[model samples]
Target: MSDVAAYPVTLPAFVPEHAPPFPGQPPAIARAPRSDTLRCSTCSMRAICMPQGLTPDELKRMEALICPSRTIRQGETIYRANDSFQSIYAVRVGSFKTVVMHRDGREQVTGFHLTGDSLGLDGVSSGHHSCDAVALEDSKVCIIPFHLLETMCREVKVVQQHLHRMMGSEIVRESSQMMLLGTMSAEQRVATFLLNLSDRLRLRGYSPAEFHLRMTREEIGSYLGIKLETVSRMLSKFQRDGLVDTHGKDIRILDHESLVRV
Candidate 1:
């Protein structure tokens, strides 16, 4: 397994705004490479998902069975609660938030997914979604049919290994989030969130320490189990301490090491 701490994480220089096609207009569609109809041959997330793990021929086979979907607009529902699970979704661009609502009207943000993140994988066995996935911005995803993927994995050792690793990574991420919620201070939670987001972007070939905030402070506070005012105050303190520079929604890490130590 690769060492997460040793991996170089950088943020992308440009994050394109995601815009969905106007309603009543036909949805635009594109075909994948013929060499692999079930998988995406030129997918940007392939490096994190399949490439570097699968052989050329295996990728070709997987590509042939995959279906690529184009941009989904911000605030659009990728899948609603209890929706039937058809395919696994891999984010090609932008971010997504999964939420679950309680009967008493409270909502908990279950997950925040970024570029190269995959959703709907957990529902493979149950065939039903337990949470709602919404795009935080205009985003694109590649949909891999579950049965096709399972068949491919059965035939390909590399594919199986990739799925195992992906699942393991998800487990670790969830555990980390649980730990943060259970034990971290408000300041520590915000600091860890920024550091994690920076690392994720960096891994995708973007600058690790500078980017725009796609989610609002209130949303961030809710996810962190803190007050919105607390979130604002901590950000201000971070700036005062020379740990980060924030101007409106844009932020630049002045000292990542110090920020992490916070």
Candidate 2:
């Protein structure tokens, strides 16, 4: 652990935002829409996930480029490292965890994607995915074929800028993770993780104070660059101090400001 004290870190809550499940309720299963009826213009998540200020004609063209939603079963990978990158997916119905395998065969959890978030951008650089995107539950994703998307970008300035912004968000996310691992203590890392998750859920229109964590403690530890025991200890300490309430996988933030100060 670093000797550096915990500081307030503002993390990026990136990408096509999902309409959250009802506050304090479990996420609902997302069903795949029929190909003919699928349109980005009609999606509930378009306001947050799509570009702002596009003309009607451009919107129609953009809608034409998106394929019908595809369902990814729980624990199944949507894509894996070295897989040919043909399209990027926007999470529409469920959550996912992206991971990368180390040379030693240990898998490191990298990012957790909720509904309305984008995936598969990792493949844009080399034309192959660099990690595995596995669904945390039965999930649905809107497939945007990248080559067609490139063509759309050439035709639509807003779409091109939006793509650039999405790529930039990925860069910022990676930089934030590096900062977390390099500068924070184990306790701080855990606290920051909870705070960040809370913010993201709130943005998605879910309950900011309480929600069910989809990832296991080990997976959370992997993402935070801490041991499982340390992560457990910190959560327990938070509960004891009335900073949070926990029941198995459920977490309620009781003291948001204190967590930020942690």
Q: Best candidate, lDDT-wise?
A: 2
lDDT of 2 by residue, 171-203 (tens): 888888899999999989999888888877777
Predicted model with the maximum TM-score? 2
Q: How well does candidate 1 score on lDDT at residue 185?
A: 99
lDDT of 1 by residue, 123-233 (tens): 666888787777889887766767777887889887777777777776787788788889999999999889988888888888988899888887788778898899999
Which 10 residues in a row give candidate 2 its minimum summed lDDT? 1-10
Query: Which runs of model 2 end up more than 4 angstroms from their true locations?
Result: 1-38
Off by over 4 Å in 1: 1-39, 51-53
Cα-based TM-score, every candidate: 0.83, 0.85
